[model samples]
Target: MASGKWKKRIRRAKGGHELEQAAALPYRFENGHLKIMLVTSRSTHRFTLPKGWPMKKRSLADAARIEALEEAGIEGKVSRSTIGHYLYWKRLKRVFIPVKVRVYPLHVQCENARWPEQKQRQRKWLSPDEAGLLVDEPQLMSFIASLDTDHRA
Candidate 1:
């Protein structure tokens, strides 16, 4: 998809103001290959990166890290900068709110056997290409595809 088209989709999705959210792309190097940890959404059970609303007193990057820990049970260093962003509609009670998600890269150092929401979500490690195929968002897929190369935003 074209970048402008995605932006237009984002604008159309949010007729009002876009909610700011953060996400973590938890990753690690295994056997000289990059592996990314993805978690399924509790409500939809669809493959997606750990993401949530902005938390008070936490930077977007830190919020992303916290979401990863709570949702995926994985932790490590998170970049202070965002590598990329994507637009997605967040389903609420009766309306689907548009959300602008700032994605931060996290270097996975540990995976906990027990963490909050462990029972509510499933985590899986996949190659960048595999993850890109699994997620439904096009911009998110682009971010996943760039995992093998160094990127900054």
Candidate 2:
């Protein structure tokens, strides 16, 4: 009972599974000040860490590195160990999809890389406490707190 155009539209409307993503929390001590890199999205301008879905041909760590450079404009060394994982609902096709995220701790070497392609992106270096508060996820906040405590010891 539907037209060709309507059927095509319906086919396109079916949503797929939520993609997997990896994120990095960059931390460093600069001149006795604790600093972390936080990024604002290009579309939503939501403040978050640098993260993205892993590329088909690349390892998860490499994808994390590339995300940091593209999103935050920073080059850093990522730890081999995973800090933690989290889950959230992502909106797609007017439905809430579940997404799994892996988090890694990065030792940032440079914070001032240029990202002309990301016109709406913004990066800031905030103290651990401030960064923890800024992050939206509770699990991520706990990880940041733990990192802060570890740094203090």
Candidate 3:
């Protein structure tokens, strides 16, 4: 439903510029140790953080929170200020989408929630260094590094 609406919106945009989006990486501290959740694509099975384009009529922060729940299947408090953004090309139509992702550092308080879409996907809990290496983008790696530092402090 939302994806269909998003496709329609994309069609209506001038010059076919993709809409801005936001995402979140949920992390938590248990016993004074920081841990983060990473998901592997069911298709490619590449480990990465949860992310998606924001739906129409939704705030960036709200969208990020939704993505965290839908993609990562975890609910937590999301930060107001964005950590950073990154850009990449979507191979579906060879369109270069500039995604202004807002990194919400979530403090997860629970787990074992329902995530139907991500059930086939592999999930793992790893340290920040491991997460940084899992991400392909340099900027994203840097962002994860900063998050690691923040988690430590």
- Index of the highest-lDDT prediction: 1
- Each model's total of backbone clashes: 0, 0, 0
**Alpha-carbon lDDT, every model:** 0.87, 0.75, 0.71
TM-score per model over all chains: 0.87, 0.80, 0.81
Q: After superposition, how far is residue 1 of candidate 2 from its true place, in Å?
A: 32
| lDDT tens per residue, model 2, 86-135 | 77665544455566778888888876546654676888888888988887
lDDT per residue as tens, model 3, 1-153: 466764664564445655566767778876787788887755467887677767779777778878777777788888877888866543223333445455766777666556856667767788888888887778778877787788783
Candidate RMSDs in order:
7.4, 5.8, 2.7
Better of 1 and 3 by TM-score: 1
Q: What value of lDDT does candidate 1 attain over all alpha carbons?
A: 0.87
Please list the residue runs of candidate 2 whose C-alpha ends up more than 4 Å from where it truly belongs after superposition.
1-18
Please, what's the RMSD in Å of model 2? 5.8
> Rank by TM-score, descending?
1, 3, 2
lDDT at residue 104 of model 2 (Cα atoms): 83
Better candidate number, 2 or 3, judged by lDDT: 2
- Stretches of candidate 3 off by over 4 Å are 1-18, 93-98
Q: Which candidate is the best by TM-score?
A: 1
Q: lDDT per residue, candidate 1, 26-54, as tens digits? A: 99988878898899999999999999878
